[model samples]
Target chain A: MAATIEDLAQAVFDGDSRKAKKLSQKLLDAGEAPLDIINQGLMGGMSEVGVQFKAGTMFVPDVMAAAEAMSAGVELVKPLIAHEDIQSLGTVYMCTVKADLHDIGKNLVIMMLEGAGFNVINGGVDVAPEKIVEDVKELHPDIIGMSALLTTTMLHMKDTIELLKEEGLRDQVKVIIGGAPVSQDFADEIAADGYSPDAVSAADLAKSLVGAA
Target chain B: MYRTRSLYTTAGFQVQQHLFWQMLTDDQCEAIVSTAEELLERTGVEVLSEAAVKVFEEAGCLVDGSRVRIPSTKIQWALRNAPSRVTLCDRKGNRAMMLENNEAHWGAGYTPTEYYDQEKEEKRPFTLADVEEFGKLAQMLPNIDFATQGGFPTDVDEAMAEVYAFKTLVKTTTKPIVQHVRGLAQAQPIYDMAVAVKGCAKELAFDPFVALHVSIEEPLQLSADALEVITFAAEKRLPVIVSNELVSGFTAPAESAGVMIVALANSFAALVLSQLVSEGTPFITGGFFTNNDTVNELHPVGSPEVSLLGGGFANILRYLRIPSYGFGGATDSKISDAQLGLESALSTLCAGVAGTNVIAGAGVFESGLASNPNLLVLVDEMACETERIMRGVEMDEDRLARGVIEYVQPAGNYLATKHTRYYFRSEQFWPTLMNRKRIDDWAAEGSLTLGQRTMNKTKSLLVAYSPKALKDDVVAELDKIAG
Candidate 1:
């Protein structure tokens, strides 16, 4: 018997990445539409994970694992779906700011944004402002998120925003900053568009920023 | 519209067994008792009051001027005369506390000179208003068994502070109080106020609402003022708490055994005095122990030595079958920070484990110089934690969870089961000021620290509080006496 789309969704919900990939392959082999598989199967499971995570029934690692399964399943169907039909809430270019090697907080935000149906370009750790600017210009992402953990490294958030202003790309995207030391006051002082104290709130800030934009 | 009421009441945690932290052996305790008896016969105790000396003289002890040498037989006779268990009843004649066995009750300490203002984050001299507020706050806290005279208020007349503090406390709180007075003169008015609230002196005597605290001056001296209070309290049949503060290496011997001997001996002297004043009087006595800092010479309230000595003395008191009071939940930290938390929690847990009845100094900080209302809430939570720790482990049929275990075998979760729902809340020690929330949720709640949360909780509780009103006649009489 052929595995159904619901089975793929259940695999994603259970955070079974290998099973999700196998099920996604099975669904694609059965001649199902890749967009329908993503929207109805992968996103279907991920939306529930989002709800559970917000309700505190599902913790951070659980959501991260589920998002991993979703990403793996999405990867399997990416070639099958047309570029224009890849449905996401928005595109977000995210990174840990320059001079800071911290990636855990930034990675959490990426996972949370991906779980919320956003296409997150994870410009990984030790991300320079020039590289972010180049990627943002190329990707035309709707939102940009930055993270820094140390009080000394947090000033790089201001430097990154200043570089964005210098590149005349500050107004194009909604900028957000986060980390332990980054407060809402610091965000305003640095002239970033928004601030979030934690990963979940970072994703929510992205969604609302894109919505308002 | 129909009103709906919930059928089941919430089941809160109740600590079962008393935690016994006995550091001294039976032989060691007996040795201390005999040594104390020898000291009573050899060095003797200085009876500052002539009446107290006469009472000792009549008891057939050697009375040489103010020094009355008591025989071991008299000490034994006094110990036998005092009741082993004393109940400090509330104003309504309710058994608020049973000071017996390893049962522990906690309350605020006596007579700190300063009060910690939470909003200002500064220490200030206490006023009469602070006493009233402390009484109300203590009454609100479930862990605080009795309200205490928090500190001597600088705003009131120095001579009348005790009376004013007592008057304010009795009117504001219905819980039993542990009061410390200036002299014997203040004891009667405080008793009169309790009697007025309690309806009569006899009922108050039957179940005394107040426990008079008298401390023996250090380095082997019993003052006349202390004897006056003890005699008055004994005659009124009120419970007297004879707690002696002896700092090791300064007022007492640096070694634990010697300190223990001196402290126990001091307590024995008071016990003898009370029994002599009135036979079979309910009395609580213990050695309140602390250590002196070698470099600074400052007496540190939360030393490990204090706990060991306190525990050893408590064991001796239990051996003698008398209720004991000792210091717990006090700190040497000037602020209610990590040091205060760590010190207060450890000391209080030690005291509770030692089974100190009516453990004092719950809210005191900076080595008993200041009292913090916020720390009071924190210490109360610590007491709740101590109770949970001392509750130890239960091994009954239901607690064994055999049925739940069989139903949910390996790889099966007990969550969402009826058994889990029934027992989960009752089994855990839930804290109010302590945060168990996630980092995100904590940040969303304004990122308040533990101390801040306690302050907010305390402020809200105090603001929303209206103590049970005293009778009009009682109020008039109290005011008259206060004036």
Candidate 2:
């Protein structure tokens, strides 16, 4: 029997990445659309994972295994996703603000956002506010994610936001801020669209603000 | 209802204690030791060093390539030669800690990538100066018995980090040090620096002020680096803890008995190697066990199973009567929070109750990736609490308080009695971070939580403390060696 999308989802939920990869590759070989495979097979398993994680039925390693399975299938199908496809992902631009050499958190957010199927463009660490505004202009990203580990460097996030407003791109792009010292109040004070404490929440926040969620 | 056990302190003062904590039965311990010995005999450990392999082969262990299958008699021979206790001295030539029966000493982290900056309140890559300040803080803390560099300095040349770290510790703290030398090439410079600080090599070796920490990779593989350091430390007569990374559900089996087998085999291999190098070398053996589960918002370092393994492993060590080490008071949280408090307190208690000698890794958080002075103070307080618990309820007549009870009848006030005044200070656990004030009093003091209080305490300790500087000539010598 040809494995259906439900069978692919079950393989993903079981964290059997080999099965998930093979099944997903088979589905694509059988003339299934990449979008349909991802949405029904990969995301379907992920949604169940979200429920299980929330209900305490799944652990972090379990969740990670499932994510790996989904990522395995997504990696196979995402490249086949055409540029003109109506389901194409919105772009997310990430950077660690000025004077902050720390980028572990920022890099994690980039990796996770990419895993969530966003086209993440990292601007690298210690980026000045002007460079951030320039990247936003050049990229025309749907979302801007800025991070700063130090309180001294966190002011650069506010500067980047103010630059966006000055350049009249504030309404064009939604801004999200995150890091260890960054707080929701700081985000509100800086007039950002949202603040996320970590990578997972940052991905969700970016999705909802871009209307992807 | 508790039976009393009479014990004597190191100072020979008699005390009464009542508590019997056990994580494994006698039969279970015997099974573990014998099985681990059998596992070694059946499946040999991979010895990376060719010279060490020759030494092992000479001792009649069956060698196939790098794999050396150790005989049980070899382990028994190693155990006979190794000391049951190790005495460590401070940099000032003061005897600091005795890693032996009925005692556990606390200390800070040795190797971490990042450090929590107090002024910035954020973690960043550690610099040479950060270690000096952190070492100073550890020296200042009343409960921290030994000091470590706390973080690897990124600013220095990679090869000189260990030497420079030892230099910083020599300058900042008079406490005993635990140094992590990554390779044998980096080992001699640290030893030379310590010798310079303590006058001569023989003097330093006689009453060692520092201990070497070397790691054995799990799945029963001893790396060349660990082998060289153990051999060097054995020849130098310095204490060395040849530890293994026993991450449950990853490295060793999650089952208790199986965990013991691998943990013991790896440690015993190191012990045999150390004895093989130099008989009567002060050697300590233990593994860093983390129960790799994040259930209930706990880090692996803070997980209850690490403590469970610690308690069980401590008993196993006692059963073998080997002076041992155990890890405690670590967390995965980036900042001090409820989770941090829970993790630190539980793991620290397990180490103390299990009577682990040299409870290591006090200041570490973020699963040992980062060190924070605030967490160090928090763990110091936890160590104090562990001391109180280990004191147990004294079962003497005076402690039974018959005279006090007769002096003050029911419904009478003991607060005004001499007994209350005499014993209250020692009997009650006085918390430094915990607030037990009236609600208004707490709010009046800015409504501080325990984390905030811990931070405040850390800052004040740093402010009020000034470690005695080394002599100018000694400083110059250390700097020359460091360079």
Candidate 3:
């Protein structure tokens, strides 16, 4: 046999992203369908990772590595996928809001979302609401995730939502808010669709919002 | 029949009282001060406040915009004028603490935002109640000599939190407080409160109850607020602790010596400011120093480098004959774990040996951002260990006990002897909360962890705590001043 899908799955499961990319290219050269390599080989390994993570046999970093490997394999097949199917689950626009330069939590959510095979556009730290609204209009993401470490900057998240509503883009995507100072009540009062305490749960919330979970 | 004697009774063993261990050589200490002096002359300091710049200018120092270049003689004059020994009194005007020699005083760190509740195993913004409880705990704890405004209370007005915390501390404990204030504006109310407690401003000035701490901006700078407080402290005749923050490879040079020079220079600048304000203001000099984790790029507060730098700084300050303020009994670990134990022990040991005066950073965790009462209880145990280590071996004929050794030489032990009883209580260090149970006994009693045992001990301490009440008249005066 020239190569098997099992080899690709093994590379991804081992979190060997470089090897994953190489093996994925080999499978494609062997005339394997790109979708077959993704769903069966990459996602298959990731599914196992999710199971192991829930079972407590695998940790967050391990899952992250597996997700990274899956992402590497998926990058090889990305050009071949149909435009509508580019983001397998959904796309998210993430940013730590203006006047809050803190990014530890925001970056965590971005990593978690990307690991779950979502296209994450990390709108960088100290991001203004206008810039986010402009990006939201251009990207038309499936979910908008806002984070702020400071209580003052958290208000800007509400302002961003208001701008989204004014621009008539509120109905198109779900709004998810989180951070150290952010509470569920704050989210509810601001008309956010969902809220999560931490990154992993935020990824799950993003999945559920897009009807993928 | 011979009676069985256990060295460790209910809790654990203790180290006998000893002298603080020294880590650096005399030549090394002299080099550090020289380096600090050179840096001060070459780099100068950015004094942000116009008033402070004016003061520096009037003191015959060269002022270029905000930067003030003070010659070595100016610093020497300030050092000579500044009181080397500061006596901090309790509210009753009793001289409770003398900050001199190589004596180390373990106290709490100031303004931690989060308080870790052991019962719930959760961290939340500390309320005024937590501040009050911390005061009570500090008052009751044997190892903690003084208290700080432990945390910012969420319930109180954000601007007034420091004064409120001070009010709570003054009421809850009679221990001398190292008050953390915002600016000269806030210092007035705190000064008034101290004056009320000590019967008058003149009496408060003569026997200072609260010592103010002001931090300088890193890389040779002082904020307007800091200068204001320094001036007020100088005028009020209260002791002031000038601290600086220097993270290796970030705010300061990656070299350990460079970081020390930066910190000490900042303290020297503050000393100059204080002397110009008033020639004989009592001052302590030291600051925060920790190496940046080269790989993670994070400031690990409990790094071994922190211990080395802290210990080195203490030695240098001792050589300078100024009271030293440095970190001790704190950890970078977020939770109670082996890492916490190791880091806290190492830092406390280094601080104890190095002779850091007014050693703070006890109970602080998560790299100085959070604090817990239980963690404080554990850190107290570590302080006791440091105290014992610092005490070292008390070498004398009585300690040797040649006659007693001969008497118990062959078969009999020293149990039930008058010499043993007389020396047993003083010779051995007894831990109040440390677990020393047999394996079976420990497992049988539910296999509690050190954290659990500490929580239990902390709870009892809080329950058993009875505040040494401030008189109603004093309370009324305090409330009026705070308002």
DockQ of predictions, in order shown: 0.03, 0.01, 0.00
What is the clash count for each candidate, in the order shown?
A: 0, 0, 6
Q: Tens digit of lDDT per residue, candidate 3, span B1-483? A: 122333234354355455755676888877877878887788899898999999999989899999999898888888888877888887777888788878888887775799977678779998888888878888888888888867778788888788888898999999899887778766778888888898887898898878988777578888899999998889888898888768988988998888888888888899998989998889887877888887876787788888888888888888788888888777888888888888887888788778888877777788877777776777788888777767777744456566677766765556434456456556667777677755645787889988788888899999999879889999999989986
Please tell me what DockQ candidate 1 reaches. Answer: 0.03
Candidate 1 lDDT for residue B359:
89
Model 3 residue B130 CA deviation (Å) reads 1.2
Docking class of 3: incorrect
Per-residue alpha-carbon lDDT of model 1 for A1-213, expressed as tens digits? 898888888888877888999999998989999888888788788778777877767655566667778889887887787878766888998898888887767887887787677888988878888888899889999888988988988888888788889999999988999988888888999999999876777777888887832
Top model number, lDDT: 1
Model 2: what TM-score? 0.66
Tens digits of per-residue lDDT, candidate 2, B1-483, equal 121333332355466563436778889888998998898899979999998899899989999999999999999898888999899999878889998885888887776778876457688888888788778887888888888787788889888787788888878888999887887877888888888888999999877999988787577889888899999999999899877668776688867667768989999888999999999899987767776574643336777777788778878888888887888888777777788888888888888888888777777878777887788889999998888888887756566777788777876656435566456667878887778765645887999888788888887888887876888887888778666
Error of 3 at B280 (Å): 1.4
lDDT of 3 at B107: 81
Q: Which is better, 1 or 2, measured by TM-score? A: 1
Better structure of 1 and 3 per TM-score: 1
- Give the per-residue lDDT digits (tens) of candidate 3, residues A1-213: 566788888887777788899989998998898878887888777777767766656545565567678888887787897787555687899988998887756776786687677889998988898999899889989999999988888999899999999999899988999987787778999999999876667878898988888
Best by DockQ: 1
lDDT of 1 by residue, B319-425 (tens): 99999888888888987689888888998898899898878888887888888877777888999999998888874556667677777687665543446645666
